[model samples]
Target: MTLATKITLVRLALIPLYAWLATRYGSSVSAGQPDEPFRLAAMAVFLTAGLSDALDGWIARRFNQHSALGRVLDPLADKFLMLTALIVLCVSPWSAQHKVPFWFAGLVVLRDVLSSLAAWAIWHRHGRVRISPHWTGKVATVLQLLALGWVMLQLHFPPSWIVMPAAGLFTFASGMCYIAEGWRQFHHGPPPP
Candidate 1:
């Protein structure tokens, strides 16, 4: 019900719009087709969603509007957006050289699936727990989003290969960090109060 949560909800709403724009109108500006209104609109929607990810988080933290719902929905929105973008990038021919490599996308997808299951199991058993994400997890997500946006916007200055591998590595590392943290929490209980 807070403003931060409202912003998060807006982001959740944008997910399908982003996906629809990306898949329904995805195309390559680098491929020189010219006259790409759909592609342009898709990029705009994607960029807006990407920026809103950070904005909503800042709103929650800066305004002290964090809630249990915010904690839950924030990560859910993030994962959904990332999953949708990855799949669309892999499937669409939207870029000359920035399309996601399947291996990288696959690793990210696999990590997310496992993490979701682990989190769900923990939640079901423990009830309403809010685990802080690792720094590496945050980095991984930023890298992934930057990569996706770069590909979406058709910017090649940083290039996909450099960004994608780093994204994958950070994502895997964060997953491992979460596993270790989960082990500690499940066995040891929430670290001191």
Candidate 2:
């Protein structure tokens, strides 16, 4: 019921809208009549949701409104939004020309799945799991957002060749870091409170 949590929920609600618009735009491109309005609208919704993520986090920290539900919902919303965008851009025929590379998306998704499983195992064993965010993970997330935005906007200046590879590297590095942490947590038990 906090304002920050409310914003997070709103961001979650935007995911379906974004998916619909992005797929519609893709369909138009596949039909040989690319619709600028659908593309732009999808971009607008994506940006709004992305901005709301930062806003909610800032509000939570600044206003001391952190909650257990917020912690769970924030990451869930992020994963959903990012995964939905990746699938829409990579799998949809409309974005074939400017789609996110399948390899990169696969790496991102695999890391998330492995991380989730690791977390669950730790929780089941220890009754609690505490994972402090790593800088590499944060960098990976920013790179992912940049890559997603680049493909969504169809920007050609920097090129996906540079963007995607960099994102993939960071993602791999972060996944490795998480795997190490998870291993340590599993064997050594959760970190001290």
Judging by TM-score against the true structure, name the best candidate. 2
lDDT of 1 by residue, 53-161 (tens): 7898898889898899998888788788888889988887575586888887898888878776776776676663447878999999888888787787778787677
C-alpha RMSD values across all candidates: 2.8, 1.1
RMSD of 2: 1.1
Clash totals, every prediction: 0, 0
Worst 10 residues of 1 by lDDT: 26-35
What would the per-residue lDDT of candidate 2 be over residues 1-193, giving only the tens digit for each residue?
A: 8999999999999999999999999899988899989999999999999999999999999999999899999999999999999888887645555888889889999999999999999999999888888899999999999998888878886987999999999999999999999999999899888
Q: List the residue pairs that clash in candidate 2.
A: none
Q: Rate the local accuracy (lDDT) of all candidates.
A: 0.79, 0.92
Candidate 1 stretches greater than 4 Å from native: 27-35, 61-63, 127-130
Model 1 CA RMSD to the hidden true structure, in angstroms: 2.8
